[model samples]
Structure formats: structure tokens, C-alpha cells
Target: MCFGYWLETRGHQVTIATHENFASFVRQFDLKFAPIAGNMEEFLQSKQGQRLIAGEKLKKEEGDKLLLQQLESAWSACQGSEVIIYTPLATFGYHIAEKLGVSCFFASVLPLTPQGCLGF
Candidate 1:
């Protein structure tokens, strides 16, 4: 929403990649949203994610596969973006975006912390 507001204030063409429902939220603003494919809710809680993190009886992978999935999803959406700006959790996503030949810019919703907020 802030991004849309900023773009409107600056009179720049802005296309926002967001959930379809959010279209109403930014209705008054001149921004376009590219909805992510599939059921957004289910995508966030997929079994692949649980397996990647080693849920209950599962074993964890050498690397985080859940994060990788996120990357794939976000990167796919980045195709329509001149530049992609994502939260820190999007490092994996940014990697995929770069692989897809799009510009990626990392943004954070929180301040730097010692609790390991860095993304590899």
C-alpha cells in the first residue's frame, strides 16, 4: 500500500504484485497487482514447506527447501516488474528473480537485529 501511495505521489507508473483481494485495498490508487497463482493461503502452508523444515516426523534437508519455493513463486511474479523490491525474507526469491533476468532490490520491514535476520 505504501508503495502504491509513493508511486501515486510521484506520478510514476506502478504495478504492484499482490494478492487479488488487495485490489480493493488499493482501488483508489493507480496501481496494478499481479496475483500469485493458486490458492494463496494453501501456498503459504504447503506440505513441501513442512517437509523442508522437518515437521513432526520429518527430517530436515541440508538446505531450506521452503525458502527455495518462496523464491520460485516470487521470482515468477518478478517477470512483470521493472524492478522487484522485497522484504529480507525474500533473499531466496531475489535469487530466483535474478535467475529469471529481473532486477532485484532487497527491503526490510524490521530494523537490523542480532537474532539473525540476515539472508544468505
Candidate 2:
């Protein structure tokens, strides 16, 4: 939501696509919201996702597969963005930006330290 606000303040139109829960939250700010494919809640409730969240180590191939799924989910909605800016965990947007030939920027607004208020 802050990202959308920043871009809007700078006179750029922004449409955000994310999990449905997230989309619902951002719509309160009056930003455009599109639902990214995949049931985030269901995924979170799944054993695999739960294990990952619980900090089970991931093999490189497993990690790559997860990233690929995210990329596929984000692809269609990213179609018309002139440029893409993504939060750190948004690995999907990087691939979409590349495929669309748009500039891409990645950032993590949350502090990396363990004691930081916004962990993710």
C-alpha cells in the first residue's frame, strides 16, 4: 500500500496484484487490486507450506520450484506494467518484468535484523 501511495504521489498509475487477502487490504487505499492466481490461504494451510514456514531447510531445486510457481502466478497480471517494483519476497515480479521487457526494481522495506518490527 505504501508503494502504491508513493507511486501515486509521484503521478504514476499503479495496479497491485497479490494474494486475495492482500488485495482486499490494499483496496481500502483505493489502489487498483488484481488477484494473483493461487490460493494463498490454502497454501499456507498445507503441510509443505507449514513446514517451510516452520524453517525446514529447502534444497535449491525445491526453492527454485517455488519461485517458478510464483512467477507463473504473477505473469498475466504483470502484462502492461511499464516498469515493475517488487518487495524482496516478490521473486515472481522479476521474471515477469524480464519477460515483458520492463525495468524492475527489488527492495525490502522491512529491516533484516531479527529484532526488527516488520520481520518480512
Candidate 3:
């Protein structure tokens, strides 16, 4: 949001594609927002989702690749945008944008990784 606000203040139009929760938050700031696939909150509440995020579960089949599906949906949602500024969890945006010839950038807002805890 800080980044989007900064860009918006500088006269750049910014659109955020994320979960409905995040989209709603961004909308409160008067910035453009688009909903991405998968209910983040609902998924996070699931045991499988919690295990997957904690790395306690390994992908065994197509059904286990929820992360990939989420990213793919995000990629699809990014179409027509000038650039895609994505969070770490959506790293696939960078690759997808590259393939589509769209600009891509990364921004980390939450320090959810252990490496972030180390002050890196």
C-alpha cells in the first residue's frame, strides 16, 4: 500500500490484483483493485493450507499444487496491465510477465520468512 500510495501520489495509476481481503483494503485507499483467484483466508484456515504454507506437506499430485494454481490465476489477472508488482508469494508473476513481455517488479511488505527475521 505504501508503494501504491507513493506511485499514486506521483501521478502513476496503480492497480492491485490480490485476494479479496487485500483488494478491499486497497479499495479503501481509493486505488484500483482487482480480485485474484482463491480465497486466501478460507484456504489459510484449512489444515492442508496451513501445512502447505508451513512446508510440512509435500506435493504428491496435481491436487496439491494450489500455490501454482494461485500464481497462474494471478498471472491471468495481470493481463492488460503495464506492469506487475507482486509480493514474494506470487513470484511466478515475474516469470509470467516476462513471457508476456510485460514489466515486472517485486515488493515485499510482510516479513513472513525466517531470512527476514535474521535482519536481511
Candidate 4:
């Protein structure tokens, strides 16, 4: 959110695409909000979410389903975008940018592992 605000201050139009749960908070910064599908709060209270929080890897099918959902929603949110700034978790951003022939940047607050860096 701060990054979006900073970009706005620099005269750039910045919109944050995130879960609906964050819409209010994102709007507080006066940033345009493009809501991605999913109820993060409810998810966090589910068994799968609990497993994820416990560091358990998701089953392959479950992971794929989640990825597909994210890809679809994020693609819609990114329409007509000239540049895409995304987090590591949103790996679909790279593919979307490639298809759109636009610049894409990866931003993260966490340290990247050697394997993760290689993947990027």
C-alpha cells in the first residue's frame, strides 16, 4: 500500500489488485482498488488455510485449482495495464505480462531463496 502511495505521489496512477477484504484499507490510502476474488478472512479460518499456516504443502490438485482461480481473477484485474508489479506469490503476473508484452516487476518484503531467485 505504501509503495502504491509513493508511486501515486510521483504522479503515477496506481491501482492495487488484492483480496476484497483489503478494499477498505486500500481505499484509505486513496488508491484505486481492483478486487481479486476470495474471502481471505474466511479462508484463514478453514482447514486448508490452517494447514497452509502450519507450513503444510497443499495437495497438487488443490494448488492447481487455487492457481487457476488466481490467474483468472488477476488477469481480469490487469486488463489494459502497461506495467505489472506483483509479489512472488502472484507468479501468474509474469505470464500475463509476457502475453501482454508489458514490463513486469517482482516486489517482496521477504528474502528470496537461491532456488526462488533462479526460478525468477
Candidate 5:
């Protein structure tokens, strides 16, 4: 909704890739969507996903892999955009942009990750 509003106000064509639950909502804004496979319920069924979401355990290696997968998915969805404005909270987005050799500008609402954490 926020992305759609921003795109409308700025008069930009925005493509949003999300789960089916949001398809109808995004359609209301006439925004483009590349539907993502697997819902939150499916992810929660995974051992690693369950552990991460439940805060029951932490697996840096597995978490990193999942993050990379998500980034790749998002990058694929945003292909062909002239510029991608990635919100700072999306650490995976930043990495995927850099990896794809795309120009990106980041926005931040508050301090979350440490300055050096992004490897700037």
C-alpha cells in the first residue's frame, strides 16, 4: 500500500511482487505484481523458517542462505527497472542490487543495523 501510494504520488510505474493474499489489494492500485511462490504458512513449516520466526533458535548460515534466496527472488521481480529505491531495512535488497550491478538509493526511517554492517 505504501509503495503503491508513493508510486501514484510520484507518478511512477511500480511493480510489486507479493503473495496471493495481497494480490487483490495491490490490484486496487493497478500496480504490477509478480506473485511470489509459497506463503508464510509454507515458510513457517520449514524447520529453519520456523526457528527463525519463532525466535527459538538462530542459525547464521541457514539464515544467510534464506536471505540470499529472498534477495534473488526480489531482484528477479524488479528486473528492467531503471532505478531501484531500496528501503534501508532491506539488507538483502541492498546486496542483491549491488550484485546485479544496478543503481540504487536507500531510504531509512531509523537506525537499525550498524553503519558498518552494510559493508559500505
Candidate 6:
């Protein structure tokens, strides 16, 4: 969210594609909001979510289905975009950008290195 705000301050048009629950929060920063499927609160209360919180991985088929759903939602939100900026969790953005014939950039709020520090 802060990143989107910073980009907007630089005169770039920023649209934040996230869960529907965050629409109002994104709008608070004056950034365009694109709805992504799923609600965090509801998910957290689900059996699958509880399993994940307990450190158990989903079965392959379950994981694949969830990934497909997220990809579809993300693809829908990204239509007509000239560029895509995504985090590690949203690596599907790269594939979407390729399909759309657009440029893509990777961004992350977390440390990328095993050393727990950014090289730059």
C-alpha cells in the first residue's frame, strides 16, 4: 500500500489489485483498486487455512486449484495494463505480462536474500 502511494506521488498511476476487503483501504490512498477473489478473514477460518497455520501443506491438487483461482483473479484484474509489478507471492504476474505482451517488474517488501539483508 505504501509502495502504491509512493508511486502515485511520483506521478505514476497506481492500481492495487488485492482482496476485496482492502478496496476501501486502497482508496484511502487514492489509488485505484482492483478486486481479487477470496476474503482473508473467511479463509482464515476455513479448514484449509487452519491446516496452513498449523504448518501443514495442502495436498497437491488442492494447492493447484487455489493457484489457478488466484491466477484467474489476477489476470482479470490486470487486463489492459501496460506494465505489471508483482511480489514473489504473485509471480504469476510474470506469466500474465508475457501473455499480454507487456513489461513486468518484481518487487518485494521482504528480504530476498538468505542473509536477511538487501545487498543494495
> What does the lDDT read for residue 87 in candidate 2?
79
Kindly list the per-residue Cα lDDT of model 5 for residues 19-89, writing each as its tens digit: 55667877887777765444555667788667867877665775666556566667787777756666643
Per-candidate clashes, comma-separated: 0, 0, 0, 0, 0, 0
Model 3 TM-score, 2 decimals: 0.75
lDDT tens digits, residue span 1-120, model 2: 675777787899898878766876888888988776666677768886687789897677755765565667678668788988787667767877988999999867575555422322
TM-score of each: 0.50, 0.72, 0.75, 0.78, 0.58, 0.74
Q: How close is candidate 1 to the true structure, as a TM-score?
A: 0.50
Q: State how far residue 8 of model 5 sits from its true place (Å).
A: 3.0
lDDT of 1: 0.57
lDDT, candidates in the order shown:
0.57, 0.75, 0.75, 0.83, 0.65, 0.82
lDDT of 6 by residue, 1-120 (tens): 676677777788888888789889889988999887778667777998899889999898866766777788999999989889988767888999999999999988575556412222
From the highest TM-score down, the ranking of the candidates is 4, 3, 6, 2, 5, 1
Among the numbered candidates, top lDDT falls to 4
Candidate 1 vs candidate 2: the lDDT winner is 2
Candidate 5 at residue 37, lDDT? 44
- In model 3, residue pairs whose N, Cα or C atoms come closer than 3 Å (at least 3 residues apart or on different chains), thus clashing, are none
Residue-level lDDT of model 4, residues 32-103, one tens digit each, is: 999887876787789988998899998988667766777789999999998999887677889999998999
Ten residues in sequence with the least summed lDDT for candidate 5: 111-120
lDDT of 4 at 116: 40
User: With candidate 3 superimposed using the best TM-score fit, by how many Å does residue 81's alpha carbon deviate from the native?
Assistant: 2.1
RMSD of each: 7.5, 5.2, 5.2, 6.3, 7.7, 4.4
- Model 2 scores a TM of 0.72
